[model samples]
Target: MSTLSGKTALITGSVQGIGLAVAKVLAGAGARIAVHGLADAQQAEAAVSAVRSAGAPDARFFDADVRDVAKIEAMMAEVAEWGGADILVNNAGIQKTASLADADAATWDAILAVNLSAAFHTMRLGLPAMAERGFGRVINIASVHGLVGSINKAPYVASKFGLVGMSKVAALEYASAGTRETGGVTVNCIAPGWTETAIIEAQVQARAEQFGGDTEKGIADLLAEKQPSRRTSAPEEIGELALWLCHRHAHNVTGATIPVDGGWTAQ
Candidate 1:
């Protein structure tokens, strides 16, 4: 039987990038998928179609702004009515770079709302039902910055670190009862390093503008200093790890902040 043959997985920010990749991977593993993102009806449908095409037994899209708690709650309620999710992947996030001396309160609020608080909201709304059902998987897509520091990304770092702590607490709360021999619900986090995503591309562009319009030099310096592997991670690779965290074989693994970064945190 497929690992997730009878499970339903809900993934946020799933319209593109890491979220989209994770959705497709889970769908291919036989999980009925709920793709959530901030998008119009047409765009949402397109994502649903893509998931279905990737081999999901069933698929749908939920549109909501993660920064809005009320909207997130409403969306989760709607999802619960449609048969609650068995796997919740908190993959939605936004990156706003700023030094502490120059950080704006509004930007900090927005970043925290999306990157950290959205996961909290989802877990609060999603966990009780999971505990009741005796099965659940909560995976947060964090970053290497959660484990180590970098320049000019205070909000992002703080949010991811908070998320790691939250995941550990949730795991302790929801771990299956029974001498730790059997597996039930689990919460874990993945801290990815630099990935070749739109976000990274935007950062590269910004660096190029700052460095006399030399994009290659900007990317090279970024890679040389950051990822020891000198290569950006693939979203699909992260997707595979996310799938593993949801599998029955990984039942014993919980509360860990696993890094998929290319040796970024090691330094």
Candidate 2:
């Protein structure tokens, strides 16, 4: 069965964008959702409701700021008591655009804290139990920047690159934790390039207005220089790949940094 029937999925930054999209797909596969994010009461509730409606046996939101290690530890303890994160998706991330010389200390700290260090904490807390159980899936939401780079995004690039490196270490460490019968412990990254998320909506809107409100034209124009496919991936597309990885068939697909970047990395 392609079902995570008795599993619990803890997805960070799941209130919106790729995180939320991933949550819904896992829920649809019958996994219970342990939602985490920095969202208001209304938005958090909406995320839980969305997952539940998508087919989760249950869906509950865990409030925690990923940038804070103490908060993340507290949330992990709570999740352990509830059950345990059978599948952990480190999707919470923050980005700021700045030149290498211009990037401030605080900005660098915040970006690394949320994007890289936070995943370290969660994996440390969650992977042991998974190893004991002989099954787990750790999906880190990295970026195309993890594999390459561009201008005016020093900290963001550094954080993503760090994430990619860290995930490889995790993958190798737990590569032999399970067998064919069990799904096995796997750690992987989804390196998405210019997906249609709120993160890029402002840019899209600005370009769309410039092109007489033709959003398609705006998207095409924005992706022209980079993404060879010239179309941004839908958030749901990323979610679908995450779901595929969670399936038992993908047990051997550990340590992979799969790109849904419309061929950006291919170049």
What is the alpha-carbon lDDT of model 1 when measured against the actual structure?
A: 0.88
Highest lDDT, which number? Answer: 2
TM-score of every candidate: 0.94, 0.95
Tens digits of per-residue lDDT, candidate 2, 1-267, equal 339999999999999999999999999999999988988899999999999999999989998988889999999999999999999999998877778889899999999999999999999999999999999999999999999998878888999999999999999999999887998999999999999888777778878998999989988888997899987899999999999999888989999999999999999
Where does model 1 exceed 4 Å of error? 177-182, 210-214
Clashing pairs in 1: none
> Candidate 2: which pairs clash?
none
Candidate 2 error regions (>4 Å): 205-217
What TM-score does candidate 1 reach? Answer: 0.94
Per-residue lDDT for 197 in model 2?
86
Candidate lDDT values, in order? 0.88, 0.93
Q: How well is each residue in 1-267 modelled by candidate 1, as lDDT tens digits? A: 267888899999999899999999999999999999988888788889988988899998888888888999999998898899999999999887879999999989998999999999999999999888777899999999889988899998899999999999999988863233334788999999878787778789887887898988888778888889888789989999999888766778899999987888887
